[model samples]
Target: MGLSILGLSRFQFAMTTIYHFFFIPVSIGLALAVAIMETMYAVNKKLVYLKMAKFWGKIFLLSFAVGVVTGIIQEFQFGMNWSNYSRFMGDIFGAPLAIEALLAFFMESTFIGVWMFTWDRFKPGVHAIFIWLTWLGSTLSAIWILAANSFMQHPTGFEINKATGHVRLRSFMDVVANPQLWRAFPHVIFAAVMTGGMIILGMSAFAMLHKRTQQHDGDKVFFTKSIRFGAVVALVGAVFATGAGDLQTQFIIEDQPMKFAATEAIYNDTSDPAPWAVVSLINEEDKTANSIEIPYMLSLLSYHSTSGSVKGMNTVNKELHEQYDAKFGKDMNYYVPVTTLFWSFRFMALSAAIAGLASILALWFTRKGKDTLMNYRWLLWIMGACTFVPFIGTTGGWLITELGRYPWIVYGLLTIADGVSPTATVPSLLFTNIVYFLLFLLLGAVMIFYSRRVLYQGPDGEGELPAGKARAAERTSPVSAQSTGSVSGNAGGTERSVALS
Candidate 1:
């Protein structure tokens, strides 16, 4: 019954978190893009720029709403489903979460409201500042959350309390400055940027394709610039994400050698040089695997020296058991599921590679002009469909990071089985899992519906300053232009010759 409850609780948390993250990358990425667009509009005073900002801002708001709704439940689940884990690490983990809520979530929500309502009232510069603040808030929120997660991967600045059997915060700065956090944070930020860029690229491609068929220039220039901007940003994001991922791998090799070995399916210890497995067939019972490998590459990549030795999973596990067993007083399973980690790593790497190549191709096609971009129908179709690639990579990367931690909920200090809530029941966990899944399903549907509606409407609907001001100016402007048989221009300079009643 205890194991069943633990499994259910893990499933529930994983489901909720995965759903929450579906919207998070989109929200963060879109926030940055919208902020950039608003900044450009404030400086250039271009109506098209304003249109772009408002259009994308709508999608960002929808994503943010869904993300927040899904995120709120995760907090409750932490206390209810895994009370033991919460109690064990809450002292150290709760600090960053509290800061996230107080400093980041509040700031983001408040500024978003101010930015939304003050569109017509505030000056363009002030309005842009509000959106920029919102993006900054979102980024700060991510940093704090990542800081907490990093603590789980590499426990630092905390000492275990022998009396209470709980971890206590020893150095706040160490928790915040964990090497894992800094290495992982940049990768997450870059991935968010890439996700945002791909969304813009895909949506702009759709709009452009629609305009081509419909013979409408209403948003041609807007989406043209959007695609170009997205391409450049995506290129930069993909490049940085790749570099950050490499650095993160190096860190993992140094900090969590067992995870690295398991990820590569290296079961036996090797010295002088080690081969990087491209693919492997593992027999868990026998503790062996047959693999296709590149000689010396693993050593070269892991230590930056071809001659450096790389410890295998078997050696690392034995050493971990010997080192920790005496202190923890329990048999430990240090080896994570190699199959899951191995495939997830590959999926993340492949998806990122594809996104990078697509961005480069997009930049190339858009560099010449819109006409040249349109010349390749296949490329446009690919761009329009490539929006989900970053999300895939982000999801897979997260799975690898989280799952690689395995039995230990807080690295070497705590096991996940030990962290399960003693009072949790199987039926309650199962019920909540179903409920949360259905709740997110409904939320996801609504998000999709609203997104489609906004995309269909384009940027010509309400909240457009030029269109609204033009109508207002037309009503009060001199009647001589209306009464006189002559073409007249209002505040927006679009020629109009009509007699008013």
Candidate 2:
């Protein structure tokens, strides 16, 4: 086995995937938030809620657009760089991807277009329904994608075809019901919601600060409500994310013991009650490390009992060799990069903790009696800066998940070494890597620029109505009679009604 083509392919895939994820969580989170705001508008007929929905909707649309463009490349790479793996899993893996496109993507895109154009054509309640449908589509899309990935982590309901050297699906229901899918799906969804909430909270903080300096109460109520909403959603998401992460860890310990051992830097088997390592200096060569240990915590976490035994890397590796060496004709090392996994896990945990705490503070300060909370400018600044915390946590969690899998592309079925395309060459892969890197960089830059511009504009009247509908609104509401001629125009013309055509 050589590192030539295989290593470069892994690098390229990781770079694209990480970049792609930067937009996905935000899109998913914002979609749900937008739907809630629109629903409020539908129920109360308040123009402020409509303005809120429109402002956040602009950001969501940009994220969804860029995410879709970048995601297309992932499918292509599966064929171009990892053809062998594609061939092997095609029978079982292709089904979910196909379903995502047919059932979710089309539905999301179609409703988004209708929602965008029908702003003045449909009644407010009907318009809200369109946005809700779009949100449903986006949520369904995530479920399908995660379902496909969970199969790779803990494969289920598949049988090998001896004649053709492929795995075929035996039960679609089993694939959808995989325990790992349920564990991972909620974590990803809540994290995405947290990401969206942070973005809204941060941007709202900036707007509030900017408005406060001007002594403007024109949009004060609007942005203030947004801050409270974002904070509450973020707090709930953080709490759920922590619970889901704990469940995921228990699943990991059960299904991939070697990965669990590697994550904790465990080298040698210990007694029935194992201590959890808090911090460690790993010495891979000597298979020993200096560490702080929390007595019985690992056993408690792994089995809910302090007396349960947890095997370490040394013992697990020996067992794996004895069981598979002759059958696979190779010596397998079960250890992953211990230091990287250790730090990534800690960073992810710490970030989630910070998000939770910050959200609590934000919510408390923004409450009615705690109007004094806004007087502290530094708190607002901190809340604004926390926008990136969920992104960092998300990236770290994925790194730990994918990298911890190490040699296997599909657990217990196919090794990454056996998965790369036979025609892949170091030179070809390196050139393509540069091309893809530059292409995505340009796309990412464009997405950032557009998002910033929209954020600064503050969703006043942009895209609120089509040209024809705007003309119709102009005729129906005489400019001479009202201060502003637009639909649901506010006192200072800074806010507009979000009525759909």
Candidate 3:
């Protein structure tokens, strides 16, 4: 096994990332949705709007807590597992990362804490502002983190520090403002929105599926409105994600040709024309790809011309080795993991296609008091299936990215083998691995179970939730001036809805 250190680190990283991502999309989407509903309530002086906002805000709050905890772990892992990578790219990557920490992360974290414990204490108008602040911070945090990753794919505006064997910032502005960022970040944002949408739609569908027995008359109406809201938002996000994904494909072909070749399983080692394989492809093998393919699809994606060809992985690998030797005065291994990148890309594409179609079709069938078509048994089944699609999409995007950067921990500067602690023995790694694996398993299960309990057993269970919780009541029922005036807040607090807004 030589060590399995790489395998272990990869596993731990993936598990942590997947778990963290599950919480984020919902937090970002729900925050905005809640803010809009609250604003509507304040404007119209309608309690239904307030009830709607508070109920959904409760769900968002749950997602935020889990997201924050899981996210902190991801930041620490970069330093823990890939310390060498951090040292090498720290100057460049650390810029956006630091900004995210200072400008976005702390702001969101602080405001969220205020929002959570002070609903009864804050003014209604002021509280709404804090919510919006949290929402912006979350999304901004995403943009900065993504800016760092974009630099990896298209290593822009950095100078080599030969003495340190690392890249230094030639211009911090250049690293942060790469053109690649504009595309990748929006694509990720839309994907996040889609994940949020599916969760909303999936829950709404579950309620609808069991409509006859819903405990409260108000519950059915809320679920119906949510279904409309979710299906529409999901469809819009899906369409944006697909378009951005296409643009990303084109960008990858030009910026990381080897990765593009590896992803498509192009092994013939030629250029000037590229073919898009439409199905599964066998790698590190002889004979042709076993799949349907469009002869010039890759060409158009790569060069904006039907006749131009994309390079193959074999040829690109050979060239990379030659280039490494020529540039560094030494032989080097060009290790690109084909299978992981290949499957992850396909999974992302396919799942996205299905999610987009499902959302749109669901809306068309159910729109404008026209849900009979959506009442089809299969549509319900697909809606249920949509709950897991975001998980798949997030994981797929992650694997394609991290796997594509194999061998090198930080682009051309450091390899994974060089990143491990020399004094850290295999026995030590194994012990830690076992501990982390068990701990992680327990943590993941607890989060899922807790979240499910909140979703399934809390509202729909036997008893009604306690009143006087502004945010909690908002989600379960339409809030009125009655709710606003119900609480005698603590001294230095608003009269209605106790905790400080």
Candidate 4:
């Protein structure tokens, strides 16, 4: 099959972006988690909390490092693959990215280093401040990044320069304060938090299982506390994520009705008090769907009541053609990938519900002197598997956000066809795509390897963990002098310092 430059460029970008985004939420979420763990240690001076902080901090650092590397590559693609889009959006888009790099990223990286290296140097409370700062910085970084993205979605705070045929920033405050940004940012942040919570809950569950098998009572206690903490965090994130997602969807109904319409696979104008499609058999060629819908649910969801009519794809497309035909072209297609949106929305929503349910069950089973949790091996398995589920939800949400925009790169201002770089060749794009794919595979493998290594090693660096199932704890008579006092495991002669370990 032949690869057009535009198609290749889009594919390459999609691959790189998806891979990059896989770690962004993880990093942001983990930063908060690590900070919370450290703060708990600071507040209680509990050795278990200290162990929790150190153990999870390793994963946080790894995620942050990989995210930074992938983010650099993501930024480069803007210039390399979408030069025309960059040239058009540079004045509007560049500001947030610049602030993110110079202010937010710099603050995050610096404090992260401090937190890592000076763990023992500062008092507990002071050292904890560094991680809290890192979390704040990472959060701020997300805000700036989303601010830039929101501008593309809504295109506010800018004026189209007639002479140059480019958008110019009219007000920085307005761009940063975009209503779309506020509506979307909470959903993303809470999702990130949920992502973090799931990872912690899963890892802790696995650790608990391993320790229980080994009959290491101390380790089991450590993991039990951690698992419960993770469950609370997960539940909070999941609950807020759902609420925020609903609010964002409500905004989308007004702001981007076609996107909302496509998500439900609605082609014809809906009756007043529209029905919500639970499932659909969509025909792309015919632009129609055979749906199983719930009465008035769509109207309730869209307008917070069961009264208003929701516009459908066909109706919106016709209106769009009429409005933009003179300025753009009559042949412009406003239709998006309906099937993808239909499935993605369901998957995203379902994943969030699953996450919430798992968290709730975990909390219930482990409640008030209940030793029943361990007996439910299936529950543990579900919790562990949930580590990967939030990624699916986040990925699906992003797919809807970006792909639903479809023909527009900077909605209404520029089309995706005209945004790609003219000079990008098929061969070069293919080569880079292959290279980046292989690189991502390597990164993924390394992350898995190291993460597993950390899990196997447990909170205590007493023994080297084998590649397979949990092994018996090998207690050493002599403790390592360099080992941190906070860790519960007996540090053997082979043990390294906490920071290095």
Residue 408 deviation, candidate 4, in Å? 0.4
What are the per-residue Cα lDDT tens digits for candidate 1 across 309-350? 778888888888889989776566777888877777877887
lDDT of 3 by residue, 1-501 (tens): 236766666565666676666677777777777777667766776666665566566667666765666666666566667677667777887677778878887778777667655656766677778778877888888888777777766678899897997889998888777877887877878887777777777766665555342655556556666666777677777788888887887777766667777788776654556677777567454524565777777778666787787777767777777766665445565646676677788888877777777777767776776756334757776787787787788778777666676555555656666765444455655766676667667766866665554454323332234554535545443233344422111111000000000
TM-score of each: 0.88, 0.88, 0.85, 0.92
In order of lDDT, best first, we have 4, 2, 1, 3
Q: Runs in model 4 with CA error above 4 Å?
A: 211-213, 463-501
Q: Which of the numbered candidates is closest to the native, going by highest lDDT?
A: 4
RMSD (CA, Å), candidate 3 to true, equals 6.5
- TM-score of candidate 1 versus the correct structure, residues matched by position: 0.88
Candidate 2: misplaced stretches above 4 Å? 1-3, 211-215, 270-272, 306-309, 461-501
Per-residue lDDT of 208-272 in model 2, one digit per residue for the tens? 66643225454566667788888888888888898899899988987887788887888888777
Candidate 4 clash figure, as a count: 0
* Best-performing candidate as measured by TM-score: 4
In angstroms, give how far residue 289 of model 1 lies from its true place: 3.0
Score residue 316 of candidate 2 by CA lDDT: 78
Instruction: For residues 1-501, write the lDDT of model 4, one tens digit per residue.
Output: 149888888888877777778887887788788789878878977777777788787787777667766766776787788889888898997788788878887888778777776755789899889988988888888888888888878889999889889999999999998999999889988998998888888887776667433476666766677788888888889899999999999889888888999899999989998999999999989987999999999988878887988888989999999988997899998899999899999999988898888888888888878857788878888788888998899879988898888788887888888888888888899999899999999989988887876776666644355533223333421112233433222100100000000
